[model samples]
Target chain A: MMTIERKPPLGKKVQLMATCLCDAFYDDAAVATVQVLEHLGLTVEFPQAQTCCGQPAFNAGDWAASRRVARHMVRTFKGELPVIVPSSSCAAMVFHGSLLAFEHEPDLPAVEQLARRTWELADFIVHGLGVTTWPGRFDAAIAFHRSCHTRGSNSAEAAATLMRSIPGVNLVEFGEAEQCCGFGGTFSVSFPHISEAMGRLKLQHLRAAQPQVLVGVDTSCLMHLSGLAEKEGQPVKHLHVVQVLRDALKNGGLL
Target chain B: MKFQPIDQFATTLAPEKRQSVYGGTKATHEKRTKLLAAQFAEPDHLRRLAGEIKQHAIENLDTLLPLAEERLKAGGAQVHWAVDAEAARRQVLAILQRRGATRLVKAKTMVSEEIELAPFLESHGIECLETDLGEFIIQIDHDHPSHIVRPIIHKNRREIAVSFEKNGLGAYNDEPEVITRRAREFMRKKYLAADVGMTGANFVVAESGRLVVVTNEGNSRFSLAATKCHIALVGIEKIVPRDRDLALFLNLLARSATAQQLTVYTEFIQGPKAAGQPDGPEEMHVIFVDNGRTEVLASECREILRCIRCGACMNVCPVYRQVSGHAYRSVYPGPVGAVLSPLLAGEHFLDKADLPKASSLCGACNEVCPVNIPISDLLLRLRDKGKREGAPSPGLPPMGPWALLASQPLVWKAALFCGRMLDHVPGALIPVPAFHAWTGCRTLPKWRGGEFRKWLRVRKK
Candidate 1:
C-alpha cells in the first residue's frame, strides 16, 4: 500500500495509483515514485487493487470493455487520497475518459469523484506536494520528447520544468515537441508499415539531438523507441522523467 | 472542361476499389517520408529554415508582390491583380478574349479549381483541356482532385479504362502506360492547337519575377512551350523573396511528395519568351489571384499560406488514407485541407465544420510538411473556431458533457458507475452521434455489477 502526503500538512492523504504500464513493464518507476514522494516528506500509499487504465480498450473503440475497466479503477481508489498516477497514459484515462465511460452507469457520481482526484505523477509532485527543488543532478545533455497525451491531452509542463530545474543538465529543444511519436497503442501493430515509418522519422530526430538520454513522461513511447534504438545500436538511453528526478533526489544532488 | 461535383466522379468509380489503390499509394507515401526524414537527419534545422523563410515572406508580402509584378511586366508578361475568385475569373476571361484564345491547354493548378476558372472559361466558349495525365483524367471524368499530388488517386486502371472507352478510344488495355498513351494522344492535339496555355506556378520568385512549375510528366513544359500565348495564374501567397529559396523548397518538395531526388521537370519561366528564343509564347500574362488569401494571410491563420502543395501531409494522413479525399468535400483534402478548406471556403458551408473533426489530431501532417506548417495545432484551432461560431455540430457524440465530467473527479466517478451498469443493458444507449459512430462499429460490454472501489474494499477486508 502507498501512503499519500497531505499538501499544506493539513489536507487529506492522497493515494498513489501505480500505472499498469509502470507496474508491469517498469516496476522501478512505481518504486521510485513512492521513494520520491517519501523523500519530499510525505506519506505514500499504494492501492494494490489498481488494474489497467483501460486505454488499450478505449483507443480500440471498445467503449463497453473500457467502462468495465474504468469502473473497477474508480472502485479500487475511491476513498484513498486523491489518486496520483505514475503514467501519463493512465492519468489521461482517468482525467479524460472516466466520465464518458460511466455516463449512464448506476454509480456515475462515484466514478466522477474518482476521476477528479486522479493526478498524473508530475501533477501530483508539482501541484499536490509542491516540491519545487530536488537534491539530485545529472551532467549530461538531454532531449525531452513530450508525449502527446502528456503535453497536448494533459497539462504536462511540470516534468519538463522539473528537468530544467535539475543542475548540470542541458535540455535541448527539438521541433514540434508536442507531436505524437506514432506509437498509437495498437496503431503500431495494426498499421505496422506506417507506424515503423513514423517511428523511424522520430528516431532520426532523436539521433540528431545526440542526447545521452531521452526522457519522457510515458514509458510506452520509450519502450517502442528503445526497441528500435537497440536494434540500430544507438547509444541513447530512455528513462522515465520521474525516475531521473527520483534518482537525483536519492543521490542527494549527485548523478 | 468544367468543374464537376466530387461525388459524381467518386461514385462513377467504386469506392472500395479506389480504397485498395489509395492504400498502396499511402504505403509508398510513408516510405518516402521515412526516407526523406533520414536525409534531413536534423529535423530541427529544416524547421528553423522553413519557419524563418515563411516569416520573412509573410512580413514583406506587400513589398514582394509589386516587385514581382514589375519584373514580370518587364519580361513581357502582363500582370493582373484579383481581389476575389469572381474577379480572378473575370480577369482570366478578359485575357482569353483579348488574346482571341478559343482553345486553351492547362497544366495542373489548384488555384484554377479554387476559383472555378475552367467552368467559367468553358461557359464563355473557350474549350479548356487539362494536359497533365492526372489532371486530364479528372477533367474528362469531371472530378475534383482527390490528392494534390495524385489527382486521380481514387481511380483504378480498370475504372479509367471504362472512362477511356466512352471517350471513343475503344478498350485497348488496362495498363497504366496504355492509359497514359490514350491521354497523350488526346491531349497532344489540344496542345498543338491551343490558342493559349495556362499553368499554375509552384513557386513565384520575387527577385526575378520567375514562375516555377514542377511536374513529373513534362506536360507543363509542353503546355507552355507549345502555345502562342501563355497565362500563368498564381495565388498571391506563393511568392518567395529570392531565387536561392527555391533550392531548399525544391529539395524538400519532391522528397516529401514521392521520395525522388528531383521531379522530372523543373521549368523556370522568367518571362513568356526570351528575345532570341526560337519557340515560346509570343504573349505572356500572369494573373495574381488574392481570393481569401489576404484574409487568411492577415489573420491568425496566416501560417497556412506557406503551403507548397507537395501533398506530403495528405499522403501520410491516416484519416485521408481511410476515407479518401472526396469525403473532405474540398478541392484541398487531407490534413492541410482540413484547416485550409474551412478557412478559405467560409464556415457557412455545412460541410466546412466537418473538416476540422475529420482528423484524429495525429500530428503526422506536421511531421512531413516541407514548409513545417503546424497542421495539428491549426486543426485544433479550427475546431475551436467552429465551436465558437456555433457551426452546426458535426453530429459527433456529445463529448462536451463527457469532457466536462472527465475533468472533474466526483462527476466522473458517478458517470463511470452508471456507465458500468448501462454496459449490462441489452439495447444500445450511446446518446451521442459521435459515440454511436464508434459503437456502431464495435461491441459494448456488461458491467460486473460492482464499482472498482467496492472490489478494493472487499479485497482489503
Candidate 2:
C-alpha cells in the first residue's frame, strides 16, 4: 500500500540477473523470482548470457579480473529494462561494486547504466512495484536475516515488509538480526573458524527466537545459517522470501 | 615474534577469548549508542564538522605544527619533534633523565602504546604507573590493552577482581566500584610521588598551542597536575586548526567513544603551568611524534588519519565482536587498525598483512565512523597494496580462473551445467577444500528447477 512512484511500472518488462548462486545452488528461488514477477504482470527476461557479477574477484582485490567479469554482465544485460536481482549482494555488486571495478574501463557508462537500473527483488516488489501486501498466508513463526549487502541496497526494511505481508505469518525480531552471517563470499573459505563462529552466534540468536521458519532475501546468508543448524540437527526451515511468497501465491494464500 | 596468519589465530585461539571480550564490548557499545542518541542534537552535523576539521588538519600539518610550536614556545612550554618511535622514546627519556625522574605516573595513550613506551621506560628503570583504571588493571596484570579507549575491554569483573587481588591491591569482590576504589587508592601515591607525568593528547590546538586530554576519570588531570615536569607525547596527526575546533571534536569524541554527552573531565592545558598559576605542572613538553604518520598521509590510505581514535568502529565490527582485539596483534585493532597497522608499518607491512583480510568488508565500521572515513574502501586499497607487494596469497580457491570462466558465454553455460550436475552430488562427498570450509556451517541448497539460461533461450524461441 506504499505510494512510491515507478516511472516505468516494472511490471511491464524487466530482466532477471539470476545470480550464479541462484543458478547453481538455489535454482528454485530463481524460478520463484521469475514466477513472482510474472504473477505481478511483469515480463521477466533472463539474459542467458549473464554469468557472474564478479563480486568474488572484486572483493578478492583483483580489480582487473572483476572488471573483466563485470563487463560481461554489463554487455549481456544491455537493454533498457530494469535489472532485477534476487540476491541483495549481487544486486549491490552490480550497483556499487561493478561501478568501482569498471571505473577506468571503456565500458564505464554501460556498467553505470546497469548500476542505475539494478534492483534487489524485495525492494523491487515493495517500492518499485509499490505492493506491500499480497494474498499469501504462511502459518509459521518467521525471522529475517539481514545480510551485510542489505545495507548497500537498503533492502532490509523492504524484505521485512514483504514478510509482514503474508497474512498468517508470525514475524519475531531477534538480537544480532542485522549482523553479518559470515558469508562474505570468500571470507567463509579464508577464515572458516571465524566464519563458523559468527554463524554460530547468529544461530544462537535465531534459536532463541525459536522461529519455525527463517527467512532472508539472500541465499548466501541462509545457506550459511542453515548449514550450521543442520550440523546441530536443528529442524528449523530456511527459505528465501521469494520462494515462500511464491508458494503462498500459488497455493491461494495457504503455504 | 614471527607473523601468524589471522585466520589461523582465529581458528586456534580466538574462540575462547572472543566471548568475554564480546560481552564486555557489547555492554559498552549499547551504553555508547544510547548516550550518543540522547546527547547529540544533530549528530550528523557534528560528524561532518569533525571530519572536515581532521581533513583540514592533516592536509596542512606542515604549517599547523610550526604555528602550534610557536604558540606553545610563546606560552613558556618546550616542543620537540620526533621523526620515529626511537626518536620519540629518546626525547621522553632525555626529559625524564634531566629531571632525575625514575618513577612516572601516566594516563592511557595509544600513541605511547604505538611506541611500546611502558616497557622501554621500565627497561630504563622508570617505574611508569598507569593511573587510568582500565590501564591500571592491564599494567599490573602485565597485559597490553586490548582496546584503544577501554583498555581492559577484554576483561570481565571477575577477571579484574582476580587481577586486583593478584597485584596485592587487597582481597576484592567482583563488584566494579570496589575494584576501582582499590585502584584509585593504589594510584594516588604514585601520582604524588612521581617526578614527571606522561600522557597522550586527544587533540592539540594549532591557534593557541593548547594540549587537550579527555578522560572519563580525572586521572589525566591529576597526572598532569601533581608532577613537576609533564611530557605530552602525541601523534602528529592529532592537530586541529583552531582553539574553538575543540567544540566539534569533543562532542564527537565522547559520543563515539563511550556514548556520553561529555566525559567527566575535559582538560585543556596551555603550555604547562604559567607564571602566577596556582596549579598544574611547572614545565610542559609536547613531543610531536611523526612515527610513519607522514608516510601514511602521503599514501592512498590518508583518510585514515581523520580517525579520532574513538574505537566506535571496533565496538560495531562483527569480526572484532567475535575475535577480540588481541587477534589483530597490532597496536591498533579492528577496522581502523586493519588499515593503519599495515600502512604505518611501511616495508614490514606484510608482518601484519593479514589484518586487512580480518574484516568481512561489511561496511559497519564505515557506517559508524564519525569522521566519515570510507574505511571499507581504504581496507580494499590495503588488500590491493598487499597483493602488489607480494604478500602471501589468500590460500583459498583462486578467483582468477573463475572470472575467466564467467566472462565467456559458451564456457559459462557449460560451467553452469557442470555446477547443476555437481549439485546432485552430496556436499560431503565433493572432496573439495573450499566446499569443506563452506559446508562446515551451512548446508548447500541443492540446485532445483531448470537453469535460467535454458529457460530464457526457450522463451526467446
Candidate 3:
C-alpha cells in the first residue's frame, strides 16, 4: 500500500521479484523487466534468495500455506530497494494480498515492510521512474488484456500510459474491457470448462478487435489466453507487456 | 453431474445456454455501471453509506430486531420467530392451516424458496401458486430459479413456451408478449381464487414497523390486493435501523438489481389493511427467519449480510456468467451464493462447501457489489473456513507442499531445474491429474525456470 513515488528520483536500485510464473515458464518477461529498469538507469538487483510471492497458495484460500510461502518472500526481499514484479497480480500480492493474508499474523509488520516497496512493472515505469514517453518505437496494433487485478489500482492507467508512450504502438479497443480472461491461477485447472468459457469470450472480443498481438502485464492471464488461442489454432499471438516493450526497444536499434 | 461441484455442473450446460446467461448479466452489469456513473459523482460513497447503514443495523440487531418485532406488533401484525427453514415453513403452514386457506398466491420470494415452502405446503394439501411471472414459469415447469432477482433468467422464452404449453397455459407460443399475457391471465384466475398471499420483505424498518417489498411487474401488489390473509417471511438480516434508510436502500436495491432507478411497485405494508384501508389483507403475520444469519453475523464474513439481494455481483462475475446460477445450486446464486450458501448450510456446511471455490477471485463481484460486501475476501475466508472445518474440497494438491517448496530456495531452484525437463517430456507422459486437467484445453509454454537467476548471477560476476 506504499504510495508509488510519482515524483521521480526514486532510489536507482530495485529488487526484481521474478515471480513463480516467470521463474517457471516466462523468464524472458523477468529478463525484459530488468532490461527496462536498467534502460531507465536503475540498478536492478536480483535477490538470489527470492522464490514465489505465494499468490498461488494465497489465492487458493490456504492462508496458512500462503503466509508460510509469503513469509519467505518477506525474508528474502528485506532491503529498501523497491521490488519490481512483472505481473500485476504478483505485485498486488506483495502490496495488497500480503496485507490481507497476514492481517492477523505476528509477522504482519514484516509483511507490510515488503509491501511498501512493491510495484508492478508498468506502474513502476509510469509512476516510480516517471517514464511516460519512450524513445523506443514498434509499429503494431495490439489488444491489451487489462487483467482483473488492475481494477482499483493505478496499474491499469499506468500500463495504458506506458504502452501509449511508444510512438507507433496502437492500443486497440475491445468490448467488455472489465472482464477477466479467467486464468485465475488454479481456477483454470479446477474449473476447466468455466475458465475456458470466459477465456473463449475474451478472445472473441480480442479477435474482433483485430490486433496483431495480445499484450498483458501478467503472464498468467496471457498464458491462458494464448493457450486457448493455440488450442484452436488462432493466429493472433500473446505477449507480456514487458516483452512488447522489449520488442519496441529492440526495434528501436537497441541490442 | 446431477449434484456435482459447480465446475462439473457447468460443463453439462451447453455453451449457448451459458452465453444467454452471460448476455443477460452483462447487459445488466453495463447498464447499472453506466447509470451509477451518470447518477453519482461518487457512487462508491453511496455504496459505503449503504454498507455502513446495514452494518449498523446488523451490529445493533439485538436492539433493532426487538424494536422491529415490537413495531410490527404495535401495527396490529402477529409476529413469529423461526430459528431455521423448517421452523419458518412450519409457522407458514400452521398459519395457513388455521386460516383454512388451501389456495394461496405467492410473490417471488427467495425466502420461500429457502424454506421450500411451496413444496412443503403442497405436501400438506395446500396449493401455493406463484404469482410473479418468472416464479410462475419456474413453478409450473418444476424448475429451480437460477438467479434470485431474475428467476427464469436461465429459462429462454422458447423453453418457457414449451413449459407453458405443457402446463395448458397455451399452445406453444414463444413470443415474449404473448407469454406474459397468458401468464397474466392464468395468474388473474389464481389471484381471484386464492385466499392467502405470501411475500418476502425487501427491508424491515424497525423504526416504523413497515414491511417494504418491490417488484418490477407489480405482482406483489396484485398478490396483496386479492388475498385476505398475508404472510411475510423475512430474513433477520433484512432489518434496517429506520424508515428513512429505505430512501437509500430502495434506490440501491432497485438500481443494483435491475438498473431501475426505482421498481414499478414499492409497497410499504403497515400490517393488515390498517383501520379500514381500501385494500391489503385483513389478517397479517410476519415471520423473522434467522436460518443461520446470526452465525454469519458473528463470523468474520458478517459483511455478506449487507447484501440487498441485488445480483450485480452475479452480473459482473465471469465465472457466474459462464456457469449460470444453477451451477451454484443454492437458493442464492453467483458470488453472493458462493459465500452465503455455504454459511447458510449451517451444520450441513459441507454440502455447499464447493461454492466458495467456485469463483476465480477476479474480484469483479466485489467491484459491482451494491453494498460493498468484500465478496472476494469472503470467498477466500470461506475457503479457509472450509479447509479448517474439514469439508471435502476439490482434489487439488495440499498447499503445504507447494508452500514448503516455494519457501525453500534450494528446493525451489531444484524444482525449477526439474521444470525444465517438462519442456522435453510430452505433457501426456506427466502423471499429474492437475496437469492433465490443464492440458485438456490449453497448451503450456516450454519451461525456462531459473534462467533469469542464472543470467542475473552471470551479470553480477
Q: Whole-model Cα lDDT per candidate?
A: 0.71, 0.82, 0.85
The candidate, 2 or 3, that scores higher on lDDT is 3
From the highest DockQ down, the ranking of the candidates is 3, 2, 1
Poorest lDDT segment (10 consecutive residues) of candidate 1 chain B: B1-10
Judged by DockQ cut-offs, the docking class of candidate 1 is incorrect
**Predicted structure with the largest DockQ when compared to the true one:** 3
Interface RMSD of 1: 11.5
- Candidate 3 residue pairs in clash (backbone atoms < 3 Å): none
Indicate whether candidate 1 or candidate 2 has the larger lDDT: 2
TM-score of each: 0.68, 0.92, 0.96
* DockQ scores of the candidates: 0.05, 0.51, 0.67
- Per-residue C-alpha lDDT of model 1 across residues B104-204, encoded as one tens digit per residue: 99999999989988898889999988888888888878877888888888777887888888777767578888888878887788789899888999989
Over A28-109, each residue of candidate 1 has an lDDT whose tens digit, in order, gives: 6666776677676667666655566766555444455566667767766767376777777777767655555565578877
* TM-score of candidate 2 against the unseen true structure: 0.92
Superposed by TM-score, candidate 3 places the C-alpha of residue B201 at a distance from the truth, in angstroms, of 1.0
Fnat of model 1, as a fraction:
0.01
Off by over 4 Å in 3: A1-10, A253-255, B1-4
Binned by DockQ into CAPRI classes (incorrect, acceptable, medium, high), candidate 2 is: medium
Q: Which of 1 and 3 is ahead in lDDT?
A: 3
TM-score of 3: 0.96
Q: What RMSD does model 1 have?
A: 11.5
Among all candidates shown, the one with the greatest lDDT: 3
